[model samples]
Target: MIWADFSDFVSHSRQHFEEGLIRAGYEEVDGGWSGQVEHIAGRTEIIISLPPRFPFVPPKATPANVADVPWSWHRERNGALCLVADDDHDGLWWREAPAFLEHIAAWFESCHGDWKDDRPDLDLDRYFHAANDDRLYIYGDLEAYRGEFVRFGTAPNNAMVMKGRGTRPAKVSKHLRDQFGYVADLGTVDVPPRNWKDLLAHIDASGYLERKIRERLIGLLVLIYQRGDHEGTTFLKVTPTSNGGIDVRRLRSGADTPAARSARSGKDSVELGTRGIAVIGVGAVGSFVADMLIRAGVGRLTLIDDDVVMPGNLIRHLVGPEAVGRPKAEAVKDQLGRQYRLRDDQVEAMSQNALTSDVVFQVIQNHDLVINATADFAVTAFLHAAAQAAGKHVLSAALQNHGDTIRIDVLPPLAGARPLPASASPENHQEPTYYEAGCGSPISPTPPHTVIETAAVTVRHAIGLLLDEPVHPSGEIRQLKHTRNQ
Candidate 1:
């Protein structure tokens, strides 16, 4: 039952070649179907070995073994072609092997044609989805703990600062400079681009350094990109030539600082390296809170809101009036998402009300933490219930007394605690003067400074929640006691 279709394709191909219908034939070899398809350019052999799962799991085809085919450039080292660029393709896109068999035949024809033309792909490394890298070995796993010194201060000779631990020095010897050969940054890459050329072009485009200083191009260019964990910064290596081409290779960050030179980032390293968090609301209070959370390094964040940026929101929100009328969630993610140094797909925007979203719980489940800065009681209540039901933690915050006070509540898993009220009823919000734009409810007159105050308190509580510290009480109430003399 498993091999019926693939067996049929092979059996038919054998009979077809026997009767001269096509230039391909199949024979059993080493327990798999082996065949050669003769194209106009040349003939190439293919071996179709189906995993026991067959149609459910697509079989792989490998060409007859060849030597030293440059696994860096060719995905297949011993002439095996990964049948699909992606192995786990959707069943809808790839249901069976009949079409795949046809694909392999065509791929062989194209490869043979390209081979004879002498114009082969220069950037073939990008084609391989799963990397088969074992060429370069890091001695001592040296990169795992290497002290990181970022270039800082424009004071000539631009000094580097060691982002050291609490007891560590703010400055250290240029360890990376002294140890690595000609290390040049290709700038920040959150993830590998689909094309390997995006990384290679940085080295190829000329002028990373002065020709005099860079006469000896680094034997290996250290490319910094985002990885999948805390302290997520990682690297790769590539060798560039005079012709502006580079051979790309995996150079995982396996080096670490020796005990004598440990300039490790602090425990508060935001611990935000790659934590998945969700923020509900992106209004004035929500916007400011989101901005600080990102700055403090909460990794992946899902921003949810259904409101557009009102001209009034600009006065207290992080975004300017120029962004008026855009979805507040998108605006917040766009403006402040970059500075937080999130992952490639880390900051996501959902322009929907959390109370009404069906998959709201699923979204909450995806994150390590969920924050409700929406200040909507219904929404806050809904998230708290959802968070508790899902065995997750949620922080809900709101402004009160027309921004004179802000309240923060943290609900531990299954706490069943209702966060404080967002505001008084529509009629009694207690605004001395209300701004009216025609017919809707009157808008409260709140200052940007007040919003900033709320944001500061919210961040402190949120940092504690994310870092598992008891810096702020679970239901902390912060009041602005000092006032200007009227």
Candidate 2:
């Protein structure tokens, strides 16, 4: 009856699993099965325990004499063998009992060879036991301050590392008050210390800290050490042992620098880091456009809007219900900052209407490009005139045909380039039905997918203009009638 619960066992019968285990020299145990695997390092007794969910989850394997096995990259702190990377989704091994046992054998073989062919994993924090606390330490560049003491500010659940020991920088102190600092030291080894004894031995041998300094410290200690060719961080908590030795435990830590965030994009992000842009409107389409530009590595942004987030906006807006009553521009800015770890100077929010603001021309002149997503004819005309006077490029995008069509217009900052004719407007097509929301003007029905699709096309052109790529002078218009049913 237990086999009936799992479809996999029905196909490869429970009797087959028993026969496979017996042939592999394994015996049924009280919880699961046990077997001994031979490797170059001798024999290891592996115990595989099937989870309650059976075939839905993979069986967990661990050594019977866990303490006797040496630490390696493929071993977890809880003694379970890490058979695959965290992101691996292949289900071949867990589909049946025989394949699962074979995976365990391969893991032991890899351990025997010392994992020399394994790719480098810069995160060394996983090898050791973490402290009980949940506080996370966020740091920036520390290459210049290696071997020197640095200050940090404490918040509710996290702390920020600041450089130097003098008066705390006004920019950081405003958000987080100064709590404590740590000494940034470079380690000699690329791998993490095996255990508390190994860590204490390294500290004594390196002479990075004196007895008085180590004893005076009361909390977490951060080490900015080298890992192969790159850098890595390690957080440790040191306490005195009964034998006069020190016990060290690793803590959670992360890097928050611009270089760390943009490392995924490689060289493509380098040019965009120096570019700035201003967006007029933070509605469904505009919010997504701003978010995409930030993720693409645009260094600076100015968000301008006069509307506030309403409950109805949540269907397509970038923000959540928590930002319902807040200004659209400020909410979008906060959302982008939390997602990208942007500083205050990186994003500026202006809760003023661009059409009515007296300094709208100043904003246009400050950025490399301006994006208009207000979908208002009057606002579009006003922005085009302002961009012309300021000698800047303006990109306008809108959804038409009840969200089935997307229109994008580009006005280059050239002497002879002019705006597209009025025929380009959706108003020239069949009139769209509008739904009333009780108080304000009637709104057209545009689904979330159409808004996202429009934003993608609009941002593609914006990035092309910023990177000086060739673009059509009149811009592009796309029809999505075939995809409307979805």
Candidate 3:
């Protein structure tokens, strides 16, 4: 009845395997039973290692010889026969020996396919490394074995663990030395990290070399879905550091998840991840900011503006001349879906007159963050008060003067040191604006580059605020000058 007892579960789970292997005259080895299984690909010897606690702990099975299977989850250095890690509900790992043998046999058969064949099924590696941070960078081609984790364990001499990477597991250490012809004596010799190479080159590089590839307590799976799905097996290495800090390096095996794509493409950032953002204007500045936020990976965006696009808007707005009649918000939303590949549901184009809309507060409440670039006095005053009442962070950016200087005001949540502007006119923030006599013309005719460049600066700060990283001078007006031909 003991979970770790292999004999109790043997007859119940794998009677045929035991009987057949015994009849074939298999031998006992490595604290378990061993036998050769013949498949279409070739003959592979299996080693089943049962621990003291059986069913509860599950058994560790490995192949006696090396195998190169295209099972999506590459393989470990010691070649762990990665069945289910803990088979509770028939998850990814080996639950019962008979079923596992059948599945693994299929895996072996899959290896026969050409390397160029594109698999339709999701890769097993996709189920691992859910964090998908580009934390590891290497010059070597570790494409097949990225995101592999190995618990090198604490050195016998007891070097401190670094960022949860170094664990000095004994069996894994010896395996690295025997297989890779490198020194990994954590008890006697200290381990060296990639950065330690410079120091070791001058003194000694053989101290902690090759230990990563031979880890026994291999971190085969960076992720194992608990409430979701199951996937496993990976090829990764872990070495020790002279300063006691461990560096975990993985390959570039990719996935379609946003996290994985961000890591692979080097666009991973706090504010760039999935988020609900509301932009209350899609003019030249708002349009440019919206574009940057989308490209930065803001998950869902709601563009709010009642004004229609004009021919002049084409020069500075995100859209072209053909979109002259469409509302700025709706046009930007369409562009996001059609050109930027964002789903229609991910973007919302609203034509609500923000200056007069009573639901502006409700709209602001629905999003995680609000951004105002309309630069209208009524709209700014309304949003400032409504956002504060709804307990949301809002950023307002506007052209303060004709001399290429723009100002952005950040309202950090719960930091009510200053009140919202009473009026958006020169009387409110004591800022200057240029407006010609009756016709609404630009103060100094802002250029496309100036507007876009200013929007980029505001967006950088807005991103930080969306992540709760309030921009410095939180409620104060921060004016930024554009870099243009003087």
Against the hidden reference, what TM-scores do the models get? 0.44, 0.66, 0.43
**Number of backbone collisions per candidate:** 13, 0, 22
Q: Please provide, for model 3 over 283-373, each residue's C-alpha lDDT reduced to its tens digit, 9 standing for 90 to 100.
A: 9899988888877778888999888987756877899887898888888888877765677788988898887556687778788878888
**How many steric clashes does model 1 contain?**
13
* lDDT (CA) per prediction: 0.57, 0.73, 0.56
The local distance difference test score of model 2 is 0.73
Q: Pick the candidate with the highest TM-score.
A: 2
Off by over 4 Å in 1: 1-266, 337-343, 412-430
As for TM-score, the candidate ahead, 1 or 2, is 2
The top-ranked prediction according to lDDT is: 2
The TM-score, computed over Cα atoms with residue i paired to residue i, of candidate 3 is: 0.43
lDDT at position 437, candidate 3 = 62
Per-residue lDDT for 53 in model 3?
48
